[model samples]
Target chain A: MSRLNIAPTKSNQLNLKRSLKMTSEGFALLEQKREILVMELMRLLDRVKVVQQELAQRRHKAYATLRKAASHNGYYHMRNIANGINYEHDVHSDTRVVAGIRIPTLSVKQGAFRSQYGFADTDSLVDQTMIDFLALLESAGKLAELETAVWLLARELKKTQRRVNALEHIFIPNYKDTLRYIGEVLEGKDLDSFFTMKMVKKRLAEAAEAAEAAEQAQLSDGDAPDTTP
Target chain B: MGFHIIGDADTVLGYRFAGLSGDVVETAEEARVAFKAAIANHRKGVLLITEAVEDMLADDVTAHRLSSKPPYLAVMQDIWGPRGKRRSLQELIYEAVGIRIVQDN
Candidate 1:
């Protein structure tokens, strides 16, 4: 891994160490969040699969009944009957948060079917189609809730994964490399200074000894001259 | 928040019979426009789209699905039938989690 382009200094090393600690902690937390998000996503996906299957079956049956109604009553007549339906159902949406993700839940309040069209004009098939489709509306709402939850959780999981990867692969490694580089540089500087101090001390000691020897030699020579006098 | 729909004519009429309000869109461009308009409505709690419309605007629909926004979008089968083959649950999971989970069942 490449080291950061920072001066190899004590302060820089300390800062890198601190940030590395923080990044690793964040990476751990993000990994935990990712796990939770994945679990939530899987659960939601499972529910979605079941609800989708149920909705598909319901829709198929409803459409089959609709096709039968249209064939029996003629397309234009069926369309008119459909237009005559006045039932108004209220769909309520509620949201709950999971790991900061808002998952929406939808509920359909089915009202009692009021037959607005005349009984003399339409067959029982039209009523059946209406009932089937109405039932489908509720299932559709459920499937919507599950599928949307799955999508939201999945998206969040992806984002968290990205952060975790960046920290583990890029950020943490870079900090370690820079810290090691700074440490090696500092240690090498200390060794070089210690060797230079040792060399200077030995040279100073040799000079002091030579000056003492020269002074003794001069004093001895003067004593010999006094004796001669 | 109320429920809204964007789909083909027959699907819209069917939902209309159930008393839910929706827009009938025929082409991909119209569906895209209708989808944008429907999402822009803050009062719309859930936006239902037929599978056919979803196929027409797959990218937009997926983008909305992954976005942390409301109204929530749900794709349902139209009167015609299921659109060919859809992405399996496994594929969806892999796309999101970046791992393939072997089903125990």
Candidate 2:
């Protein structure tokens, strides 16, 4: 009744079959992609955990050291020296692809160590705390990288899942139904052709039987002398 | 390009010695206000927040930290000492990655 069934031809059915095969293949590829992305996300998540732990440990250590520096040198004196020193951290990122998702890869570089203040002004504890903070900053850079990668891959995973669902739930089954419908229509046409041929053969046979009977009656009447009106 | 420090008066004052100037939020509402200002800052590349202020603005800080690209947020322990339970970061990690961790004493 609809254009979908209008053509019910072998070629059309073959075309649909090919399309179904292609869609199935595409669904499989997408599923594989999703699996790979999920794996990468998990690995990155583990890396992030390790980095977080390191960051926290370094933070507490740094704060403790800073506290020691403050107590040993007096708060005002420590602040005075801290205000004078400057440390610059540089960061740049490049894109890394995981399962076809581009995620950023960040690299942090801290400038050369410079204690602008006189060596006697800041205690060794203060110097140690600054180094620890630098370490914490480096770890923070790593966290940012992993977090971004995990989130980006997770986003791609969601998209791949949606496509897989559509192919599995809707497209494949609908194509199957159309294939069945077309097959039924084709079989019905074949049956109609067989019935038409049978009717035509039966009519021809009846006509030939009538001709033979007429010919036999003429022959018998001629041989037996005339009979009846 | 630089860092912003947000904490109580003492923490802010201490970090200012390191030349980090930021909002001093002593209350939850003030924490939210300070977070908005800190996030809107394009010049600052990192936010140094005292753990106490961070705990007060827990939900807001988490939202902003995850959503923003720059001004990488680093929660630092207050020189005064940690306040409350110190599981905020751990809990956030669990939420993000669903990993259950065992802390060593």
Candidate 3:
């Protein structure tokens, strides 16, 4: 692996070690986050599948019933009845946080159902169309919620995966290489200084021993001369 | 926060009867404008677009779908029913997650 362009020093080694530790921890956390996001995404995907199927069925039934109603009451008559409808329900939009994502949710506050149309004008076909469409709307709302959650979770998962890859493949390895390089350089410096110190100490001891030997010989020569005289 | 719709006349009117507000767009440009305005409103939590209008502004819809932002959009069939085969759950999951999920049943 290519090492980072850093000076191989003891202080740099310390810093690299700290950073490597932190990066490994961050990678683990991101990995966990990715797993959670995937799980959440899968759950939402399953729900979306169920909701989509239900929505398709409801859409077909609702539109078919609407076509029949339009044919029976006439298109203009159906439009008029729809315009005259005063029975409106409240849809409350709120958010639920899943894995730190704010997933929007829609709920219809069901109120008392009142027949706003006059019995003399509209037929039961109009009534059936209204019921079918209402059901369709409910399913559509649910599908929207699940699909949004899935999209958001998937996006977060992709981002987390990128970060994890960078740390696992690049950042952490670079730090480790730098640390090892610095460690080897420091050890080599220590070995060089130790050898030089040992040589200097040995040379000083040898020189001192030679000087003592010369002084002793000189004293012995002076004593021999005094005795001969 | 509230839910909104952008679609044709009958789809908009049908949802309006259910007490939801909507914008009825006749063309691609109109659909694009309505979608832009709808997403601009942070209070809009859900946007239900008819499949026909979605076809008109497919790029914009796909962009918003990938953005993972607020005002989630769901395309539904108009009163006449879906024009063509809508994307299956597997296809949608692949688009969102980039993984092909094999359906067991």
Candidate 4:
């Protein structure tokens, strides 16, 4: 079998070493990225779960209040009361950024509660009820928005999680295994070449010793006449 | 092309997407066909393929890494269980951002 020459030139060896180092660095970076994504995802998930639970509760309370008011005050009266409640001075909204995600902040204007039905003599149940209902409705809307946000965020989190897992478990491992294989092959070649060189040197030495011995034997065989003289 | 789901018969049927069809793609050949069709439709922005299908079509997926069009394929672990705790996405994030964010729980 023709022996394979495995001694790469200095430049090629340098390139290979550099590539191996680069691959290692790349793997490290991928690992770090996975960690960051997971942490962020987990944090967001916690917030999402809390919001989800709170939203559900708020929705339940709002439905219950609406039901109670309807049963006691009648649907027509509730509608009229809702119309007579002036929210023009009460509702407010603002925006804030959280981890690059924009979310709206809602607040109710203080001291703006008043009845449009001129029920000053009797406490205006309609006005109070309408305000409460509107507040609940606002909370419900916010909850719906939060639900959507949570679902979308969860989907994104899951996607990122999979990607991280892929790099960590599959891509990096495969690349590393291939690199190790190449390294082993190269090392094996080096050892084989070293052994071949050692054998060739030993053979050359043996050949020289044989040549010297043959010369000495020839001289001994021809020296009989010289010894008699 | 719209989003399509591929997995075991039961798994595929469990996925619900409006107007999207989920089909059980058992072999590499079937996955390749479905993947190509999803790409051709031009309307699909994402293709969620099962991890099993992904493993079968690994070569095909790698071959198309240079494409810049839509139908960005994403592999999901089987809903039944994870194949394994593969590389965390945190690693990819670190690759992009150069910081460790996912810590031990």
Per-model DockQ against the true two-chain complex: 0.57, 0.18, 0.44, 0.03
| Model 2 segments more than 4 A misplaced | A1-15, A67-82, A117-125, A200-229, B1-105
**TM-score order of candidates, top first:** 1, 3, 2, 4
What does candidate 3's lDDT look like per residue over A1-229, in tens digits? 7799988888888888989999999999988887877777777777877887898898888777777877888878777777776544455667888667777677755434457789998888777777776787788778777766666666777888889899999999888888888899999999998999999899988888888888888888878899888
Candidate 1 colliding pairs: none
> Higher lDDT: candidate 1 or 2?
1
Question: What is candidate 4's CA lDDT for residue A219?
Answer: 88
Model 2, docking class: incorrect
Model 2, native contacts kept? 0.07
Residue A147 lDDT in model 1?
A: 74
> Tens digit of lDDT per residue, candidate 1, span A20-64?
999989989998898888888777767777887888788888888
Number of the predicted model whose TM-score against the real structure is largest: 1
Classify candidate 3 by CAPRI docking class: acceptable
**Over the full model, what C-alpha lDDT does candidate 1 score relative to the true structure?**
0.80
What shift in Å separates residue A136 of candidate 2 from its native position after superposition? 1.1
lDDT of 3 at B83: 84
lDDT of 4 at B18: 18
lDDT accuracy of residue A197 in candidate 1: 95
Expressed as tens digits, the lDDT of each residue in A1-229 for candidate 4 is 1222334444455555676577667667655654654565556456546654554464354445455655576766554444433333232434454434443333433334345565643243443444554443333334323332333333444555566676567655654555455566678889999999999999999999999899888888689678977
Segments of candidate 4 deviating more than 4 angstroms? A1-61, A68-112, A116-125, A141-149, A202-229, B1-105
